[model samples]
Target: MDEQALIPDSQQGDLNAFNRLVLAYQDLAFNIAYRMLGDEARAEECTQEAFFSAYRHLGSYRGGSFKAWVLRMVTNACYDELRRRKRRPVIPLEPLNDTDEEIESPAWLASSDPSPEEVVHLKELDTAIDHCLSTLLPDFRSVVILVDVQNMEYEEVSSILKSPLGTIKSRLARARQKMRDCLQGFEELLPSEYRHEQEGK
Candidate 1:
């Protein structure tokens, strides 16, 4: 069924219907969390919490752009998590790059029949992008993730972030500039097309 059909059922306390929405959105939600927090476990936790919060608040949903509404929830959850972590920071024994072996092999990045060389290049590009994203402030990072990575429009991101459109545009501009500077350092690892795109920035 279409997502619109699922929403009413989910709003009526149908667990299965809500779960279908979860299945549809969890990957994108988790990716947003992961990109925001840079921790898989925390990302998973935030995604689950966002879903729970959504189910509870479903009645309050005023229609229009359910996906964007869900994203707003997940974004709030991530922000909350970030705030908590700020209060009690813990150092991980493993470095980010060391722990990202699995991230380097995401199924979404795979072609139906990717060559060994292509796979390696994809991994490198993913790592490079991740590193660049990590250097950004959380607010700037979130803007770029929503706009550039998640392919959201400026208005949608502004709505999700509850910020003004001009604020969103400014954050996106600064974030993109940061990423361009960061990516320039990793130009050799980027695919030719991506390298050209970066260079053109």
Candidate 2:
């Protein structure tokens, strides 16, 4: 059955259809949680909690984009997790191992002859991006994550964020500009080609 038909049926307590929906969106939901929380364990917990919360509130979902609805739920769960963490402080950074420095480029940017120095530089850039993302207010970060990292269009981000399209565009533009500024500090560490290209732009 199509996703639209399955949603209402699932809302009415069809475990099979709900499970199918879970299968379709679990990775997307978990990745969002992981990105937001920046902790694998906490992200997993948030993902599980979000799915359960969604199941409990399934009846409240009144048609239209089920993916967007579930994503909203996931985002809410991540927000709640952040709030809870604020109430009870914990050590901030995760411990890293040497192997973690290995670079695996995104498919869109992958190249065959990347060097070890290049790998480390790209990894540092990734870390800088994560740091800059963490600095953003949650609302702004959510828009960036949804539109940039998750590759959602402006309209989908508007629907997911429940905001005006103009707001979404403005927030995304500001977020990207902020990230670019944050990355500028690391220009010396970047590949010379990248540095020259960025300087030209």
Candidate 3:
């Protein structure tokens, strides 16, 4: 069934309908939370919280993009997490596995067909991008992630962030520029071939 149909059922207290919506957008919710917070564990928590909040507030949801509505809830949860982290900062120790081996990169970075060199290069690039994303102010980061990464339109992003369209565009531009600068400075860490490829672009 279309998610639109699911929404009304969900609002009417149908847990199965709501769960279908959850299955549809769970990746999106978790991805946005992750890109915003840069932590897998926290992102998972935020996604769950957003869904709970959404379920409770479904009665207030008038028509329009249900995906955007869900995004707004996820974004709010991330903002809350960011504020809490600021209030109680803690050092993050290196992650270790059951055998006590330090985990160099997240297992999610592994793929079935990539060569070892390809995997390492991809991980390095991924790290640089995440670092650049983390450096952005929350407002700028949200706009960029929603627009560039999530491929949202300006109007939808404006709705999600509750910012003016012009403001959303402006922040996305600045955020992209900052990411470029950060990554260019990080060229030393990437493979030389990848650096050349970027330069050619």
Candidate 4:
């Protein structure tokens, strides 16, 4: 059955239909939570809470896009988790004598014969991205993630975020500019072929 059929069925307490919906969206939901929280255990907890909240509130749902509804719930859960973490910060203990060795480069990066200097530059770029994303205001970061990273359209993101379309566009534009500026410092990280392309731009 299509999504429209599934929603009514699941709303009416069809466990199988609901399970199917969960299976279909669980990965996407988890990834959103993980990316937002940057902690695996916290992400899992947020995902579970979001699902349970959706299940409990299923009766309240009226006609609309079910996927978007669930995503809004998941995003809210992540925001709640972020707020709670801010109130009480706890650091995880570090592992000692770790058996796992760090690989010099990811498999995709390893395939290319990048010079060591290039590799270091790339690593710096990656760090710069992480740092900039972390520094973003929560509202702006959420917009960036929903649009740029998750590839959500403006209307869909607006619905999920309960914001105006113009607000979404403005936030997305600002967020992207911030990311661009952050990455600008690592221009040397671009592969030799891409460096020429960048210079031409």
**What lDDT score belongs to each candidate, Candidate 1 first?**
0.84, 0.80, 0.85, 0.77
Runs in model 2 deviating more than 4 A are 92-125, 188-194, 199-201
Q: lDDT tens string, model 3, 72-181?
A: 99999999999999899865555676799976765443333334443455456666667778878999999989988889899999999989988998999999898877
Q: Which model scores highest in lDDT?
A: 3
Model 2 Cα lDDT, one tens digit per residue, 1-201: 489888988988899999899899999999888878777899899999988988999989987788999999889999999889889978434434467753343432333333344345556655555656766777888899998889999988888879999999999899888767666666666568879998798
> Model 2 has how many clashing residue pairs?
0
Task: State every prediction's TM-score relative to the real structure.
Answer: 0.79, 0.78, 0.80, 0.76
Report the candidate with higher TM-score, 3 versus 4.
3
Say which prediction, candidate 2 or candidate 3, comes out ahead on TM-score: 3
* Count of clashing pairs, candidate 3: 0
Q: In lDDT terms, how accurate is model 1?
A: 0.84
Model 1 vs. true fold: TM = 0.79
lDDT of 4 by residue, 24-45 (tens): 8899899887767766798899
Model 4 regions lying over 4 Å from their true place: 91-131, 185-201
**Clash numbers, per candidate:** 0, 0, 0, 0
What is candidate 1's CA lDDT for residue 22? 90
Which residue runs does candidate 3 get wrong by more than 4 Å?
Answer: 94-123, 188-201
